[model samples]
Target: MCFSASASFVGSAGIALVGVATLMQVRTPRTLLFAAIPILFALHQLLEGIVWLGMDGRLTPPWPQLAGQLYVFYAQGLLPVVMPMAIWLLLPSGERRRIVPFLLLGASLSAYNLWFLATLPTDIGQCGHSITYHNPRTREMLVAIVYVIATCGALLASRRRWLVIMGLANLAGLTVVALFRTWAFTSVWCFYAALISIMVYWHFRRERMARHVEEAPQDHHFPAGNGP
Candidate 1:
């Protein structure tokens, strides 16, 4: 339940290692963005760790505020867009068209969130064992609905079975967090999303293996003992 600075930092470092390994499995430029998510998630957690330090009274004024802003900027202002875009780009050519609407929707939502987060006031407080971020616009039910369609819907739409599984996992994670800790939704969901990048690692690993099998060199040599 308790998330400390040390714990966040350690988690960040561990995920970063997995993220890098996932990135190494990428076989195409289109997949690079999707593969980079875990790395970005690592940085996101690192920012939260700084926020944790601030909450513990270890950071001076302004620093904590800056960290919190950056954290929210990504969680609220950016993820909806990036998640869909990542999926869109990673999709095979024929399938890319199917995801265009979700990409557009996510981009529009991201723009609204970016504008709101940039202009509005945001505050973070320790709610029980989690950090609760207060952003009025992000709290809107409509916005939450749109955000879900943008992120999870796109993932579910993918032809890739692994992506669909990832989508389901995230949906389950969101429901659990929303049910038990609505106030800490931002913190907990982002953390859960970070862990969900494990699916990304596996997805790419499996895809890479499949690609190798398909592309593996074949022996075209004729038999040495042909009929006279």
Candidate 2:
């Protein structure tokens, strides 16, 4: 959760660096989409920093409201779709088909949430060590369950070990936030997700290294006649 400007800034900077490192490890355009997750999360944290500033009265009028809306736009509107799509893209050809249902579910959830966000009124307030985003229309048990299935489900469906671990971590985070800090679930969960994204960097780096090692023998080996 973005409790203060400093926490938000620290998270933003740290995740930004991890994002860049993850991007550099990308082997193809397909992987690039998933690699960008940390970068997007970094931006997400930055937006929350603005929201914090606005709520604290450190920012001018309208900016706080605008920032809060933008934060929700990402938190509620875009992520549901993007998370599954990213995982879907990262899956192997055989596994890709299996994730379609989750992808569709995510898209549907995103659409419904976007509509609700646009049509309903929203309120943001500080509570305890977190910020609470109030949008009654968007909060429902079914919706929350579907959201978890769409986002975390896709990751869990992945054949990649690292992705499965990431999914499990996210599920744990979601469960904790929902159980204890339902009011601040969005903020708290996003923070947890952003932190977990460091695993993305580790995954990519490991893959890249494995690829290098796999190619090393081939590069070193040569035709018998061509060998010096």
Candidate 3:
């Protein structure tokens, strides 16, 4: 009925869908790790949206007698940064064995987020917009910087041109977020990441197709023994 509720519901649903899609496609550690990023971020945004919708306005500082702020700090501030790091670190070696665990873990975290939102008051400030002492959003932004660094380093190690491009773009976007505190370009980075993911996926698929093509029997019309 409220804007915050609607946004939160939509955001949460979208993230859940992403998690489901990722579950269907995750057949490798890299995909699992990569998919986890969007999945977690989507859920984080959804939860924040939920808080916004439920409250119907900005939450006062030290809400519900300070426990509210603490809750917000952990849920909105910490989990988004933590979950992806966990998935990236603990991801299985191969896709087949990982599907169940990865899906279960990711889904569980998302579900927890959903449940947490459902139970809590919607009155919380956006992470970095706080005017109080217990602000955690700033720390979360710094955490995001760490993510950009690690992701860029990984891209360089892979030596994939598309990855390098995407990695650099993402780093640039995060830098913009850090410095200007605006995210007009961050939306562009999201699209860029999606494109890069598709390109890398298709690139590998094409390589596999080429291998198949090469391995196929050639129809060379050689005169049986004369060729030998």
Model 3 sits at a Cα RMSD from the real structure of 9.3
Model 2: runs farther than 4 Å from truth? Answer: 218-228
How would you encode candidate 2's per-residue C-alpha lDDT over 50-161 as one tens digit per residue?
8888877899878878878988888888899998889888877777997899999999999999999999988889998798888887788888899899989999988678
Against the true structure, candidate 1 reaches a TM-score of: 0.94
Listed in order, each prediction's TM-score against the native is 0.94, 0.93, 0.47
On the 0 to 100 scale, the lDDT of residue 141 in model 1 is 80
Which runs of model 1 end up more than 4 angstroms from their true locations? 219-228
Give the clash count for model 2.
0
Cα lDDT of all candidates, in order? Answer: 0.89, 0.89, 0.44
Clashes of each: 0, 0, 3
Instruction: Give the local distance difference test score of model 1.
Output: 0.89
Superposed model 3: Cα runs more than 4 Å off: 1-19, 29-31, 57-147, 182-228
Deviation (Å) of 79 in candidate 1: 0.4
lDDT of 1 by residue, 1-228 (tens): 137888889989989998999999987899899999999999999999989989999998788778889999999989998999999889888889878999999999999998988888887889877998988987888988898889898999996789999999999988898788888888999999999988899999998899899999998998689777
Q: Tens-digit lDDT track for model 3 on 46-110? A: 44443443344455433333543443444433444343443344334452343344334444444
